[model samples]
Every structure is written in C-alpha cells, then in structure tokens.
Target: MKRFLSQKINSIILGILVMISATLFLTTNGDATIFHVAKTGKDSNSGSEISPFQTIKRGIKDLTAGDTLLVHAGTYAEHFFSWETSIPNGKSWEKPITIAAHPGDSVQITPGGGKAFFWITDPQAKYLVIDGFIIDGQNQAYHGFKFQSGPTHIRVQNTEIKNTKYSAILVSIPPDYNGPSPNTYHEFINLHVHHNGSSIKDHGFYIQSSHNLVENGIFHHNMGNGGKFFQASLSGVANYNIARNNVFHNNSQSGKWSCGLILSSGEGNMGYNNIAYGNYAGLCILHRVTNARLFNNISYENENYGIYVGIASTENSYVENNTVYKNGVYGIFIGDDAKNTKITNNISYLNGNNSSDKNIGLQKQTGTIISHNLTSDPLFQNAQEKDFRLKEKSPAIDKGEAINLISKDFSNTPRPQGASYDIGAFEDIPQIDNIPPGIPQRLRLIN
Candidate 1:
C-alpha cells in the first residue's frame, strides 16, 4: 500500500510539471496572445478566458509584443497606478501591444486615495496603445495620465479625461537626460478633456514631443489653456507638431493670460480648422515661438486678443483666413518684438472694449504685412444662436486670397467656390441658380 501511494504522488507531481511547461510554451510561442481582466476575478488565477485576472496590474504582467489585454466593464479604483519598466517594447508598429475595453463594456479608472491615477514610464515602452477608457479625477488632487518618456508611436484614443488637478494628459521628457532620442511620434485622437486644473497650473492637453498629432479633440472648461505645446531649450525642441480640427471653448476660466491654444517656444507647429471661444485669449503664439502657422480658425467672444502673436524672436509666423469677432480686446494683436509676421485674408470686426480700440493692434513690430482683411460685420446667419456661417450678401464671401497651405474650409469643404476663397474659417457654399428667371412664358422659344 505504501509503494502504491508513493507512485501515485509521483504521477501527480509529473502531471503538474507538464501543465506548467505547456503554459510557458503557449505564452512564448503564440502568434498573438489575448488576456482578459474582470472585477470578479482573482489575481491567483491564470490570465485566461475562463479564469481571468482581477486587477489591471495583474493583467498587464508578462505583456509581450503583439499581446492585447481586454478589460471588461468595471470601476477600477486605485492610487498611484503605473505601467512599470517591465513593459515589453513592440518589435514594430504592426506588432503593438494594446490595452483596450472589451466589447460592450465600460472601463473607468478613478483615484481611490492616490496622488496620480496612471503613470507610464520607462524609455523602452513604445508602440503601445491605450484606448476607450474613462479616467475620472473625482475632484481629487490627482493626475489623469502622465507619460514620462516616449519615442515612436504611443497612441491614446477615444478616452475621456476630466476633472484632474494637473494636466489631463502630459508627455514630458526629462529636462536633463542623456538618452539617444527624445520623445517623438505620439498621437492623441478623439479625446475629450474638460474641467481640469483647479489647483495647479494645468492644461487640457500638454505636449512636449516632436512630430506629434492632436486631432479631433474637444478641450473645454479647464482652468488653464485649452492646449499647450512647449519646447524646452535644454532638450530637443518640438517641431512639426500639428493640432487640427479641434474645438477649444470655455477654457482659461481663471482670467489669466492663457489662451484657447498656446504654443510657447516651438517651431513648425500648425493650428488649423479649430474653433476658439469664451477664453481669456484665442490662439496665442508667444515666447520665441517661430515658424508657426494659424489658419482657417474662428475666434469669437474671447476676453482678450482674438489672434495674438507676442513676445520676442517670433518670426515667419503666418495668421491667415480666420474670423475674429466680438472679442473684448484687439481682434488681431501683433505685439512688440514680433518680426516677419504675415496677417492676411482675415475677417476682424466688433472686437475691443470701446470705440477707441481698433481691429488690429500694432506695437513696435517690423516686417509685418496686413492686407486684404475686412472690418465690417461678416453677417453671420445668427449671432445669438452661434451660427457663424456666412449669408449670401455677406462681405467676407469670396474675398480672400488663394493660400496653397489651406485647401479645405472649417467644414472640410473645398475652398474658392466663387471668384476667390472666403476670408474666414468657413467658406460660403455657393448658391446654386435653382430658380430660373421668368422668361416670358407666353413668348416661348421654339424647342
């Protein structure tokens, strides 16, 4: 009987060893692995379809390239959440690791008692995608998301980030680092960031990375600027970044000098087809930022300068084809030390505090061109209803020069329907001659 029992025990141990080996083999050699996480799961269970992991921390363990973690519907509360150094880098963009919400599920991340909700660190974490998550700050002093170091394609999409004390999203590389590459090639898409920056200096979205794209975003109700792009002099300067087709409204509620969109000390940055309203200022390009372009945007009802280019060393900056109306200060403010700036084909009217103020404010600037702009009311379809579209008899219709840089209007429509392009964010769609003139019916011509 004792011999039989010992043989049985040996068989059981051998079976467990075989199982372990099989698991390891599957994890390493699979084409792509998919893990699941649920609220009813336990950390001790294997990350499988049936026995899923409990916490996001456990689900992300051993995440390799070409792996995906699908988080089911649940409220994940945590303090100081982090994706640590063990995150494996993808071999290429085609093999990125994805952390996303499961189908027909809602995933939310809120701070339980921590300072920051999520922190993504390490230089090796590249080609990672985070999508379809709601990060709620809950009015606590917490940061929504922070990326310390990045390079080559870290994407965050379809995310709602709100009510954070600091910036809703920040990509910051260390000021004094000896890394081979700076943060570059990041993208933020279809994000809604609101009600952030109550305590500290916070932006709805802050970027310090080069060649990044922030598109189709809604930035509103933040205490600081709607979006800020800054380039540090010590590190590599941000260049070739683009912010397109975004709406910036009701930001900078603190009455500071923050604008709807501000680019400080950056080069080759472009902001186009954006709408800025109800902010302290609108579209401020300041602090030695050069080679920036602002075109085909609408700035209205802002408290200060509608389109402001200020500070020193600003040159080669072009502001064109924008509509500035009903702002509290100058419609287009070109401040001191700004050089080689071109302001053309914009519609500026009904701005400034009183009759003494003008549509364009110029102070100690050189090499500037102001031409082909209209100061009359653009005859919006309905001003109180926020319909800024042009009517048939409006003066701004087809009154702009042809700018090759901008081919599409605010509605993404092709420009220049008539003699020339319209002089605003919106291009007036040409009226079709639908009704024929009453050619005398009685005197009919031979068919």
Candidate 2:
C-alpha cells in the first residue's frame, strides 16, 4: 500500500513538472499579440482591431518581443518615431518585433519636420522587421529611415522612401559608438528609394555598416549616388557587403563624381546582376577598395564611364561578364594607381565619341589583366526596346571564362548551358525536349 502511494505521488510530481515546462515554452516562443493602429481609432482604447490606437507612436510603445504593430491604410503626419534601447528587443529572428502595414493597406507617412521619419538608434534593438510602408519626407526630414549605433539582424522590406533632405536610408556606426561591432547583417530588400538627397554629399542609400545585404531595390532620381557603401569612420569598415539584382538610374543631380552605385573604402564588396543607367557614372569601384567584384551587371546610357575603377589605390578588383554600351566615356576605365585589377569576359561596345575613348581605357596601372573582352556589337535581340538578351549565333554565347563564384546568370539561369559560360549578364538557354522517351512496351531479354 505504501509503494502504491509513493508511485502516485511521483506520477503527480512528473505531471506538474511537465505542465510547468510547457507553460514556459509557450511563454517564450508562442503566438505573438498583434496591435493595430488606424486613423479613425483612439489612443485611449486597447490596441485591438476593434479598439485600435490612433497614432503609430502609441502602437510602438506597447510592443514587446515577438509582437507586431500593424498600421492600417492612412496618411500619418508624424515624425521622429525613435526606437531606443528602452524597448525590449526580440530574442531571435524567429521572434522578431515587426512593424508593418496591414495586408492590402496603403500606409503613407508624410513627416512635416524632424531629423528622420524613423530613427533606430539602439544597439539592443536587434531582430526587428519593418515592412510595407511609404515614407515621403517632403524635403523636411534629414532622412527617411536612419539606423545608427550598431543595430544588427534588422530587415526593412517592401518599403518606398523618397523626397528626404538627405539619404532615404542611412545606416552608420558613428565614431562615438563604443559598441562591440558595427551594424551587421541588416537587409534592405525590395525597396524603392528615390528623389531624396539635396546635395552631392547626400545619397539614396548611404551605408557605412558591414556584412549587410541590399538586394532587389530600385534607386533613382536622387541628388547623389544611388547607393554609396563606404566606411564613415575607423570603427565602421563597410566590408563584405553585397548589392545584387538592383536598378539604379538618373541619380547624381548635383553632377560630377557621383555614380549609380559606388563601392568604396571596403574589402570584398560585390555588385552583381544590377542595372545602372542615366547616371553620372554607372558604377564605380573607388577609393582604396580592395577585392571589389562587379559581375553580370548591365550599365549603359550614362554620362561617363560605364564602369570606373579609380582614385587612390583600388587594388585586386575584378570586373567580369558585364554588358556596357552607349555611355559618354570609356566603357571600362581603370584610372591611375589601381593595381592588380582583372577585367575579363565583358562586352564593351559603342561607348564613347572617339575611338581612343571607346571600349577600354587604361591609365598608368600595375598588374592589370585584360582578357576576353569584346569591342564588337554583341548582337542583342532588340537594343532599341532595351531587350539585351543575345540572339542566336552571337559571339558572346559560350565565349566566356568560367567563373567559380558565378553559378547563375542575371535571369537566374544556370551557367554553362553550352560549351562554356556566356560573355555577358545573360545566358542563352537552348530549347530542349521536356517530355522523356517512353519505355519499351515489351522488353525482351537480349544480350
């Protein structure tokens, strides 16, 4: 009888422990509470859909880790919504705090006056996601979104930022920051940033952070470079970042020394599958940049060189498999002091007015390797319509040196569809039979 009583007691204790463990797990990683904000709502109400908050500030104040603030369709005229260290950060990417527009709702923020529409300044405000909002700064705010002091693992996606006094998006680790690392692993995806900067010092996106990714963005009509990636100070290195599958055009309204995209003062920075046109310069790898790689890009119709590698010790850079044409200056210009540069498998034709300035221009440089580049017309399918795909029997087809890092083309087609890789951004895919041959109806044993 005592043994039975002791077994019952042990079973009851085990059940209680299991229940406590489950409760803790749910509290840590369960479904998040979603707060709603609408213009018609009031701040005094609970932040539910039926009793929503009126302003974005009130919605943000109640957010915790794994919480979401969903703003409804409306024009919000507020500014300087600062997200500081007092707010708790999400524990991980899976439990990130999110500020987003409700699905199918158009959320526009027109800030009248402030430093920024949104300022993310806290190093501890990590693992946050901002999505699907439109910010029009009306040339009043200094920036649309400004991130500073090393906030990591943040994502801003599907947002449109425009008409700010300075950069639309600025990510910098200032000199005063005593953080452990510069802002790292942030992502800006599917963004449209345009018409922002007021001078040459400003830009569409000014990034001084390291290991960030900017992809699938459209940057245009800004006062400076469409995107500028460089170190702001010694503490912010801006190294190992990637900008891919973006379009940059019509920037540099201040004129001269600006580019559609500029990668400077960084090592191992890469730009691939991008299109840059109608800028002062299409693409620039400049100012002590090391191991910067530009591949599978299309740059044309710009004011100056399609690709310019210049100014103060740009070393060990690689420009490969890009298509450049119809620019005002040399298609690819390597200026003085650029060392150990490799230019290979590019199509540079019809670029400049004179023959001397036409395909490739090399200044006084050392250890520069230029090989397998084409100066002839690359036989586009339709140049007038801007269809840059190669036609059949084009010289660029299967005439490129195979690059180990590039496994796919601009259109995400697999490389090496023929004897070798294609020479430009596109790989011409040959037609093939989709249906397989049928098996024999009656197989006989024949040796």
Candidate 3:
C-alpha cells in the first residue's frame, strides 16, 4: 500500500509540471516579457509589478518585440521623441509590442509644447499597439498623436483625444520618402475625438495612407473638417481605405471646410454604416475619386446637403440604402462631372429649403441610375430625442432591394428581418409586449 501511494504522488507531480509549462508557453509564445509602469515607481528598478518604472519613456526604452508594457493609473506629462529617439527597437510583425493601461484604470497623457504627445517618426516602425489612454492636447499643441512617416500595422483604440490645436490624430508619410512600398494596414477603433483644429486648419482624424480602417469612432465639435482620408502626394496612392460605423456631428463649427466626413482623393475608398449630422455637408466625395462605394448610412439635420458627390473626376460610384432627411438644402447632390453612378434603395424626406429644392439634386449629367427612392415621411421613432429607428408601419421597413455587400445593420443586427431588406442604417425589429392576455369584457355561452 505504501509503494502504491508513492507511485500516485509521483504521477501527480508530473501532471503539475506539465500544466505549468503549458501556461508559460501560452502567455509568452516562448520569448516575451511583461513590464509595468507607475507614477510612484523608479526607473532604476526592474520593471515588475511591484518595482514599476516611473515614466513611459523609460518603459519604452527597454521594450523589444513580443513584450507587454502594462501602465497603471496616473497623469503622464510628456515624452519627447525626435529623430534621435531610439524608441522603436526592431518591432516585427511576427512579434508586436503592446502598451496598454491596466484594466479599469485611467491614464491621462498631456503634452508640454506645440508638438505631439507621441511622435513616432521612425520610417520602419511597424506592428505596435497603443490602447486606453486619454490624450489632452492642452490647446498649445498641434497634434495629440502623430505618426510622421512609414508605420504599418499600428492599432490605436479605446482612447479619447481632445482640445488639440490641430488634428487629434495625424498619420502621414514623409514627402521625402523614396521607398518603393507604401505604408499600410493601420486601424483606428473606438476613438473619441473632439474640439480640435483651432491653432491650424485640420481634421479631427487625418490619415494619408492606403488600406486603412477607421471604425467605431465619435468625432465632433472641431473647427476644421471632421475626418479626411487621402493619398500622399509623393510616395503612395491611397486605395481601399474604409471608414465604418462612425458618428460625425457638429464638426467644422468654424466653417473652414464644413464637412463631416471628406474623402479628398482616393481610389476604391468606402464610407458605410456611418451617421453624420449638424454639419455643412454630411459626406463629401471630393475631387479625384474613383470606384467609391457608400451605402447603409444615415445623414440628417445638417445645415446643407446631406451627401454631396462632386468634382469632374469622380467616376463609377455607388450610393444606396441610405436614409437622409431634414437638411436645410438638398438630400443628395450629384455634380455634373459624376459618371456611371448608381443611386438606389434610399429614403429621403423633409429636405431642401425651398420648393424647387428636390429630394435629389442631380446635375445635368448622364450615367446616373436613380430607382426605388421614397420621398415621404419615414416615420421615425423619435427625431427630437435623436433616435433614428423606424417606427411600426414605417415606409422604410422591408422596402429595399436585396444587396449582398453588407449583411448587417449599423447596430450589428442581422439584416433582411422580413420579406426583404430594410432601408436606412437600422433594421426595424417589431417590439413585443410581454404582458399576459387580459380577461374578456363579456363572455356569453353558446350551445
């Protein structure tokens, strides 16, 4: 019996060792390290949870690929990064670095001068994640987060950037870059940008890159434009950029460009599942655009046109399944130069200032297809409360032609809930009363 007990104890010990090895492999993927930073800690000590670093710069100095830097709750002053800064130490796509705030902790990052808080100027820096930091520009800086040139696979999310003199975030390639390739695959998600562009004319979020994604953001109360996506003049031609599920409202308040979302020049850029309001123009497809697709959007209550596709260079565009209303000017404006465009499955109502202002103001041009459009009251759930959901028996419900591009609504609900697809950014779901059946008023027995 004693021998049997010894063998059982040995088996248990081997199982525990195997579990420990598996846990370590999954956490690090073999060669990663974890570091910590806090306000009260010292840079001289080892960057562990107990002995954290004092500043972000100190933590960044020691970060390599596959490393994780966890920052605690505090107010960070600034970190100066110039051409001489050795911040990016060979971060790779296979092993990216992560810098994030602790769960449920708030980190406020404020800059000191007229520069950005985080100036990533490295031309070859790639695969970095910056998440969960509140950046305040203090009205003395030009940018909150600026990537000067040539950074790809960079993801910024769950952050609030406000009060900057210029744009809250600026990503561009340097004009002098002679590289053969373009910077690509940048993603911005869940960002809140507001009250910027007072010092210089800019957008809330300006990106000059190709194949980027700007999703799930709130941009408002800016002096210049809301957001601009275009190509760099020297190095690359931006293409296949997408802006989805964002809310742009009350932007361009000082009337510089007066656009909520503007695509200056790009090819195959897409703007969908977005909502814009209280601006001069909700969505503007400006000069030199080709093969652009805009659908499943809602634009309402703006000072001017809801959607304006202009300039002589725009061609082969598609605008469908949008809900536009209550603007002071026309609902959708197509310039004389626009060609090969398809405008269908849309609902427009109560737009235009005068009786001559039609629901759609199409210029004297050919190559335009307009069909299945309704110009009646869409019977919104509540416009006063800013709720754009469709009411019961709304004309917009299940009245749209089926399209396979987007299978979901703005709220991520599955589409085609009824016989056909619904119009606008939202799908109408019939509300059900959960109360039990009431008793009959009078019941007579029949034989």
Candidate 4:
C-alpha cells in the first residue's frame, strides 16, 4: 500500500510540472522558427527549416495555443484574417498566440483589399503580442489592425504603420455573446503605441470604451485624428493614464473638428506632456466629460484653437502649466456650459488670425481662471519655422508656474546654456547644438 501511494503522488507532481511549463511557454511564445506566407499551407510542409508553411494565416489556423507565427521578408497582398477572436472557434487544446516578423526582415501588408473585419486574430486571448511588421494602408478604407475581445495584456510594438483609412491599431470590445450587447467599459491598459501613422489623417490607435494607457509613441501627419478614447456608457472612469513624449503634428486634414489628444466622454483621466502642433485642435474635451487634467502640453500653429472645451463638461477638468501660441484663433476657447473649469499659470501668446493680429489670444468663454498668463509676444527665435525654442531674453523664459518645475520638465528641445525653459513644445535650445544642418528654415507668420 505504501508503494502504491508513492507512485500516485509522483504522477500528480509530474502533471503539475507539465501544466506550469505550458503556461510559461504560452507567455513567451515568440522568437523561434521561421514561418513563410504564400497562398496556402499545403504549398510546403514539415514546418521545420527543411519545409516551412508558405503562409502565416495557415499556420495560425493549424496552430495550437502558445504558438509563434513568424513571417519572413516579403510583401503579402492577401486580406489576412478578419475574424475577431484569435482563438479558433472550435480549438480547445491551444494557448494564446504571438505573430512576429523575422529579425532584419520586413513583412508588408498592402491594403486596398477586402473589408477584412479582424486583423490580428481574436481579442479575447489575453497576452497576445504582435510585433515588427510594416503595415501599409495603401489609401484603403480598412484599418491595419481591428481588435475585438478582452485582452488583459496586448502588445503591438516596433511596427511601422502608414496611410490607413481608419485607425491603424483598433481595439474594441465586440458584442459580448454572453451578456447584452455593448458592454464595453474596460480600458486597454499598458499599451505601447510607437513609431506609426505617417500623416495627419493617419490615426495611430483608437480606444473605444477602454481606459487604456499609451506611451512612447510617434503620431505624425495623421490628418484625421491622433489618439481617441471614448465610452458609450458615461458612468465609469478612464483614469490613471500617462501620454508623454508623443508628437502629434501635421494633422492638417480638413475635418469638422480634428484633435491631437482628446479625452472625451470619460471620467478621471489625464492627458499631459504631449507635443501637439500643426493640427486642427491641439487638445479637446467634451460630451459629459469630467475629472480630466490637461497639463504640460505645448499646442501651437494649428488651424484653430489650441484647446477647446465643449458643452456640458462640468468641474474636475483642470488646464494648467501649458504653452499655447500662434493657433490661428483663440489660444484657448471655452464653450458649451463648461463651468468652474480651471485654466491657470499658462503662457498664451502670439495668438491671432492668420490674416490679422487684432483678435488676440483667449476667445470669449465663461467660468475660467485666466491668470498670470503673459499675453506679450513670446519672441521665439522662429515661430513659423517650427523653431518653438525660445530665444535668449524671450518673454516666455521663467514665464511658467514655478511649481511645475519641481518634478517634471516640459522642455521638448535642447536649449542655450544658462538659458531658462522656453514656452511651447520646444525648449529654446541653440540652433547650433540641436538643429541639423541645411534642414531649410521653416519660419512663418504665425501671429
């Protein structure tokens, strides 16, 4: 009897070890093997180097959970997959998945294709990582990636996205089959959106009804809109987000209202330290939005207001320690029953019509604290040239709230030695040290 008991215990321990190994392998499922994408899997088999699958879609279909599908160097004109769920509808013994591009290899997904609904498989499969591919929107109406499901951890890193019709990376909660439809209230937390979206209309990534955080991303020339977050239901909170060091510029796509960074229809959120210039609107908050902070951002040279507050937006929306200049209209415009909103210690200057200088900064608004702001000329060495860095003796030097300098710095440019922090997106670094040679002076008549 003692011998029989010992054997049973040993068997249980072995089973537990197998389960743990499976879990670890699932999380780190990439960085091995080479999978090619052609037309079909049957083109070649044996999945080893001797004979690899031709297409990644086939490998994904035949793959179990914890599989990594690697695409080699080439261009794939196929529609890829449109199914929302990464988990196959019928598969059981599988794990989460990761698809990556081979190192030093480029996999291009050319668009103008089908209305493929889902791009990167299922959203329900948490811990899904898709990395290292060049996705070309090709002037098409489809998004580079369409995500649907509840992902505790989803990563799309080190990828280049260009010329997409909708958002390049789209994450949304699908119609919850179990509950009533439209139960999308969770956030896409810890998402790193970087180095994508070529122009103004090329939206980088959008979060609908998700309080996700995006960091270290580049959003350039996406004329449509940069990053968007909204909730269908207005009860929950989109809090504790950090958007820093991202550039939102050249979004000159002539839309009704284009915004650089926006926290619309969400509660308890923060949008700070972002550089939004040359867009239609630097930042916007509205539609029953509350408890949002707009701090330490530099918005300038846009077609309209640097910041606009829409109607029905009550208290807990604070705008402070920012620099707004040359916005073609009011540096800051408050509207639509926006009450008890705090706008303080900011630098709003060089604001007037592109045609005339009479209509200066700060348009008609109510319930705002427009205090301690220097309406005098900031005297940037070059405003229209995109050189927002303050020249020596510019009025913006030491022009901000002294309290904001304790922990954070909004100086986006390298400035002159012994020179103070300049207002706007760029810290006033000397052109000799920071500016590259022969980039052509881009000076303009901003004010």
Please provide, for model 4 over 1-447, each residue's C-alpha lDDT reduced to its tens digit, 9 standing for 90 to 100.
Answer: 233222323443344233222322224435333344433335458564446677665666655446666666778664555453344321122443556665556567675544322354343434555566667767673676665654335555556667666676665545333432232232222222333344543466666544456654556566567776654453343334445545566564655477877776666667776667777888877666776777777777777878777655545577766777778777777777676677665667767663333212333445666554556766765556544446777766655544343235454333322334334433444435765688658768777
Query: Tens digits of per-residue lDDT for model 2 on 158-273?
Result: 78899999889889877775644464788988788888977888898988878889987788998989998886555327788899878888898635679999888888899998
Q: Candidate 1: where are CA atoms >4 Å away?
A: 1-30, 79-85, 111-117, 139-142, 177-183, 232-236, 354-357, 434-447
| lDDT head-to-head 3 vs 4, winner | 3
Best-matching candidate per lDDT = 2
* Clashes per candidate (backbone, < 3 Å): 0, 0, 0, 28
Model 3, range 1-447, lDDT digits (tens) per residue?
233222323433344233222322215767788888999899997999999999888888888888878778989987556564566543665677777776567788888668787777766656887777788888877788787767567777777789888888888767776665364688887787889877326779888777889887778888877887865464235667899878788898534446788765668889998888888889877667778877888888888888888775677787887878787778988885887777877777778964345678888556888877777777887765556678899998888878798688766778788888887767887678999999898899999
Q: Give the residue spans of candidate 4 off by over 4 A.
A: 1-43, 48-51, 61-68, 78-97, 111-125, 173-203, 220-223, 232-241, 354-366, 379-385, 390-399, 402-406, 411-447
* Lowest lDDT 10-residue stretch of candidate 3: 17-26
TM-score of each: 0.85, 0.87, 0.84, 0.69
Best by TM-score: 2
How much lDDT does each candidate structure score?
A: 0.76, 0.82, 0.76, 0.56
Predicted structure 4: lDDT: 0.56
- Among residues 3 or more apart in sequence or in different chains, the pairs in candidate 2 whose N, CA or C atoms overlap within 3 Å are none
